[model samples]
Target: MPVNTDPKLIAGNSNIPLADAIAKRMSMHRGQAVKPIDTRVERFNDGEIFVEVFENVRGEDMFIIQSTSNPANDNLMELLIMTDALRRSSAQRITAVIPYFGYARQDRRTKARTPISAKLVANLIAEAGVERVLTMDLHAAQIQGFFDLPVDNLYASPIFALDILHHFQDMEDVMVVSPDVGGVARARELAQRIKAPLSIVDKRREKAGEVAEMTVIGNVTGKRCIIVDDICDTAGTLCKAAEVLMDAGATEVHSYITHGVLSGPAVDRITNSVMKSLVITDSIEPTAAVQQCKNIRIVPTAPMFAQAILNIAGGMSVSSLFDNETLEPIYESLYPNS
Candidate 1:
């Protein structure tokens, strides 16, 4: 059953800008100077975390928005402590709204003996008293099975579809491409939505830290390609794929990735890659380097999330927001200001 009460939005340091954007959409965010809830999450000199909720949350439905992105351990602990605090304070319900779920790529164990870190993260969140979780585009769809609580796995395909249509109205020579064989389904859906052909990059991963060699699976010659993937960790796969496609006579190569974990030499690699642009969502906040790169663009995700939260509070079906093959009408309904 959906809770009809207005939910309280609490934020952590993981992605302050994203959190503020979500709150602002709900008309709950006051400028930095004044806020309804005073969240005090601090760390000791030795790197220990402590959290305290100053405002009274007794019997309130609290929604904590925190992305378990880079610095995963620290941000995760902060969420745990804050959940504990809210539970101890007798909050009616606690929902952990994690945008970019870290450790999600470690969902399975391929080696003889290894830890399934994604399952462990699910355990930690459940153990912390989180009643529900709302996350976007998990690396592996099976990660949802690890969670005991109700999980709403939102798709970023709708977001990407709208942006692609707005920029590339003439789709005659456009092709949607998967960076690697693993992401064919994701890329296929976007291609189908935009009425474009689909292509795959067959990659050979020799070893860690080595750029993969790829071969195009479909005809991309003379076509403007849109490479799609769930994540862009170091940008090696995308950069290499872009070069391969362009070398094969591709006119332009653009990318749409959900979680931009632009770590290490990602920004530098993307800057030098043959890709025309790299569009990412605000699931994970962009770094200064990512911001400065002319090829990197961030699509605001607050309005999308804000509408999802509103639907949840009103007992409306949230999936209805983007449950169709065509997504232009959905985006317009949710973000008319755009």
Candidate 2:
């Protein structure tokens, strides 16, 4: 089914600021114009969830804005209930705009008889009556195949590339480094954008939560290295990669990730690492620790997401979202040389 524009934009408590920013980018006025529906998520005495859609949405196309980032379970439950509420209220169609899809890393069964949680989440969304899905920078691209419904997996590459070009004064000397072989495609895509050389970190995982840094695959010595990854969960991979790069004679190390799931000592690791800076998108809410981390910086993905929603609404090609010139003009118009 084709996505609809002008759908009633409903927001849960997950990431209201990002939703609001998307609203502004679409030129929708505050309050009634976009018909923002608020999902009142509450908890019962028995530890159950209760959700109420405060507005009527009968026969209207709906898009629920929520991110299953940190506190993934609570946010995921909120999205499920919102979808159910909209479906029950007789909405025409529903799309879950999940900017940071949690549990995406569990795309495969790594151990014996282990369940694929990513596939399970996909099933849950489909069962909730979501007609489609919109997400960005999933941990694994194959996860998209897990969804029965049509899924539009957006990219933060355009946004991240633009930021790198702007901030890194010596772009010509920058080398894009992938933290692992699994992310070679992602790294190459961005490296091509910035016209930088590409390298990979030949890392070995000794055990869960422990990484053994082996070697650098390409020549990164005496060049500024930028490690790229889809998500930064524990910062273990990135920090280890940075250390290896520095040891191999990299002049400086910087990093960019699409989603920053800074769990358990991630902030401390990055804060004390040899990295010059860590740039992440606002796909997930940053904790106070993330904010306090001196090396961390946030780049907004609101404009890109807003343009995508507007393009879908206007019967335009959302693939155009990846066109740098198409979106760059508007982004500059809004961000002003940013």
Candidate 3:
């Protein structure tokens, strides 16, 4: 069979909305409607997953859109299984478009008898016959090295920076903050982009998911603090950091987190926290609890992903998407009035 030059998108059940949004944005980019490949992902009585690709994928460029999010194990398995099926169907090329790559935090072994699960997951994807990977805002950038295939790690900083620029007219009083010392670089990038001062939250963690004490490393007094981080799991760190910033005389507190893994009482914690609002990317689908939370807002990442897909398919540079000139149109499309 002859190879189909057009890109074919297939999605697991992890984030159907985001996949559909990407397809819509891709359609706009191509000047023609591009729909996702018809596929069925179902479950057996014992919770085993079964995937079927209804369309002819032979010799076509295939991109599977799936986020290893809540129920991470299941979603990850679905991606691997789907990749196996695509490989068996003789797809010309297979790219895994993962908005949120789970098990990323386990990139290294901090303790004895620990496994570097991120590398293991990378191996799983490659062994399943994926040719490339496209993901966003990985917890650790070095995780890219774990994969032998080319991995394009996209950033949400540009999107957050533009959103901040549009919303906060008064840049003088705005301060970008890192929730912890490790995130200082991420926060500094955004601060530099928006031309705002940078600050860090010095916190000591006694154990996982718990912060003992948090100190504001810089003067947040009389400033509207914007905390930046990669993930918000239990919300303990973010909530505590916000409290510390407020105590340090911050006028208002907001957060721009790349991934909203809001698990285990996170929604309740954020709803009652002193933070003004929390802006997260739609990398992972928002839950009903997250949707009902008034202060939580989601920024669609579909436009960026769509552009990246188009570039990849055309043999164009994916890094060019980061430029303001290129991003302006995407940002504007998301917030047309701005």
Count of backbone clashes, every candidate in sequence = 0, 1, 0
lDDT of candidate 1 over 14-125, digit per residue (tens): 9999988887766732233323378899999999998888899988878889999989999999989999999999888888999999999889987779899999999999
> For residues 1-338, could you state the per-residue lDDT of candidate 2 as single tens digits?
54445667888778888888787766642243543676677889986778888788887778888999878998999899989988999888888999999989888889999889999999999999998888999899999899988788898888888888778767877999998899999999999998999999988898767896568998887899989998988988888889999999999999999999989989999999999999999899888888888899998888888777766656677788887887687578544564
lDDT at 196, model 2 = 93
Q: Is candidate 1 or candidate 3 better by lDDT?
A: 3
Of the candidates numbered 2 and 3, which has the greater lDDT value? 3
Candidate 2 backbone collisions, by pair: 5-313
Q: What is the TM-score of each candidate against the true structure?
A: 0.93, 0.94, 0.98
lDDT of 3 by residue, 1-338 (tens): 34344788999999999999999999987789998999999999999999999999878899999999989999999999999999999899999999999999999999999999999999999999999999999999999999998999999999998898888877899999999888888999999999999999999989888889888898999999999999999998999899999999999999999999999899999999999999999999999999999999999999999999988887889999888888988878565644
Ranking by TM-score: 3, 2, 1
How far off is model 1, as Cα RMSD? 2.9
Cand. 3 Cα-lDDT: 0.93
